[model samples]
Target: MSEAMKILFVEDEEALGMVVSDSLRSRGFEVDYHTDGESALQAALENRYDVLVLDVMLPKMDGFSMAREYRKSNRSTPIIFLTARSQTEDVVEGFELGGNDYLKKPFSMEELIVRVKSLAGCALNQENSELEECFVGKYKFSIQKQMLELNGKVKSLTHREAQVLHMLFEKRNQVLERKQVLDQLWGDDSFFNARSMDVFITRLRKYLRDDPSIQIVNIRGIGYKLML
Candidate 1:
């Protein structure tokens, strides 16, 4: 078997933390679990972990604060913030504080697993990609690495997300037909697949929104256009 991915998990809720950490261990992840932000922050810096999963609220320091402090030294490791609050500002703050992804409370194990795997895969293989990074407005995009960097903050993109962004970038300032993307990524342009592709487009637009000059435009019935 391949080496198990390591994780630094910080969640104060006893029962929930045990369950989550156990689940991750069962899935072949080596999780170093902690309950407070102080120890978690120290653990994060002293050791290397493939991913960091933190609870928003904790003793001593909150997750956001820990992440902000952690990012000062390490900006590449992907962080998934677990929060009970789903406010827009909270979510935005998490991302701004160097979080790669956020999971609201009541999330299913499957959802967390998918996110952890996707982010871990993106971070682990980054050093192995030789493809030159592409620039989109103010963002540096690495399709092979499945990541986007803006002003030093790195966002890990899902495989499908990276694929869609690459297609849009390759055909910038031109309409990229929805059918084309669907056929390539989803193997069909059916209504269900088309809608799924549209969701990705919306996320790409958000990721690029920091640069107002970069816009992913909807071309009505045709598809979409990347304006930069």
Candidate 2:
């Protein structure tokens, strides 16, 4: 209900795809239906959709292969797989391939609608949180993708780099205590864990080196502060 969500639905079953696509359209969603994997992948690459509902079994390329290609380009779009394959290994493989959620076939229409709406809502909320561009010197920091882009070149950050940078950006120009940062990030202040936090801080500082205006100052016996 927040915004009209565009959904790309890739199901091979003609009758079921029609029913599901019609139901979604009736409920204020814009649905794009594709019956084959090749066309589904083409549609997905050609257009941007809020969520993707894919069936594993398909003609030509499979759902897993399609998801892999999307991820290689750093597309963080959430995917929900709907397949009759209910084996645990299949589920695990789906997740490992970056599938966010999975639903077995013979699922309820209501359930599918609810799940899609919920996931889309979550994605929208995340987008809203990062509405403003984070200008750390010449680079534009994208919190959602955890990437720093400068002059058309982008560098991806590791998970720790992303998390630490997020916290620092949230408290820009404020001193974040070492213990507090450690506890908040690593969930502990033990000697070994403290070392890990130091490594992350070092990596973040290196990544933000392009921006002379931004510096992570270390306060002895205290913590770090983002000097902007």
Candidate 3:
């Protein structure tokens, strides 16, 4: 059997820390649990781990600071942050500081597992690989070629457009969080970037407008959801 994925998990809440660490261990993960960012950062520096699961609120140092320090020496390890606050600035700062993924507090174990496995390139249902092409509601989207074809007509998609559409298609029929999309696509969710994404969304709507069966609904205070 392959070695279990190593995780550096830092959470000050003893109860939450225990439950999450135990759950991850039961799921075949090797987790190094810590209660503070200072100790966690030291552990991270001394040892190598495949992934980092950090709680944003911690004593001595916050998760963002820990990750920022870690990145100065290492840039390849995937980091999954846990945050209780819903502020976009905190989330964006985490991304800007080099977080691979972020999970809001109260997240389920199953969702956490999926994100970890996806980043580790292990098995998330099947292979956790990038998608090349997808078909939805009479539209054929080729991400590699950045082309969308429908009803004998085709429209070229920009790189950003293709990336956004790919994400929407991947999470089709589900609410794709705007923060998540912005964090990955534009690296941060500033006002300008958010508005820019709106422009891209509009363009995508125009491209896929011919198909009445498909709809990209704007989910207020959340994000966008693609329904087919």
TM-score for each candidate, following the candidate numbering: 0.65, 0.58, 0.57
TM-score attained by model 2: 0.58
Q: Model 3, 1-228: lDDT tens per residue?
A: 289999999999999899999999999999999999999999999998978999999999999899999888776577888988867677667666667566778999997887787556432212344766779789998766667998778776544566678788889999999999887655568774576567767777888999999999999989999999
Which candidate gets the maximum TM-score versus the true structure? 1
**How would you encode candidate 1's per-residue C-alpha lDDT over 89-132 as one tens digit per residue?**
77767766666667778989987887787667643344564545
Q: Which stretches of candidate 3 lie over 4 Å from their true place?
A: 122-228
Cα distance off (Å), candidate 2, residue 101:
0.7
Please give the range of 10 consecutive residues that has the lowest summed lDDT in model 1.
122-131
Residue 9 alpha-carbon offset, candidate 3, angstroms = 0.5
Residue pairs in collision within model 1: none
- Candidate 2 residue lDDT tens string, 2-116: 6789999998889999999999999899999999889888888889888989999988989999888876764456688899987767776776666656777899988787667
What lDDT score belongs to each candidate, Candidate 1 first?
0.81, 0.75, 0.80
Clashing pairs in 3: none
Stretch of 10 with least lDDT, candidate 3: 120-129
TM-score of 1: 0.65
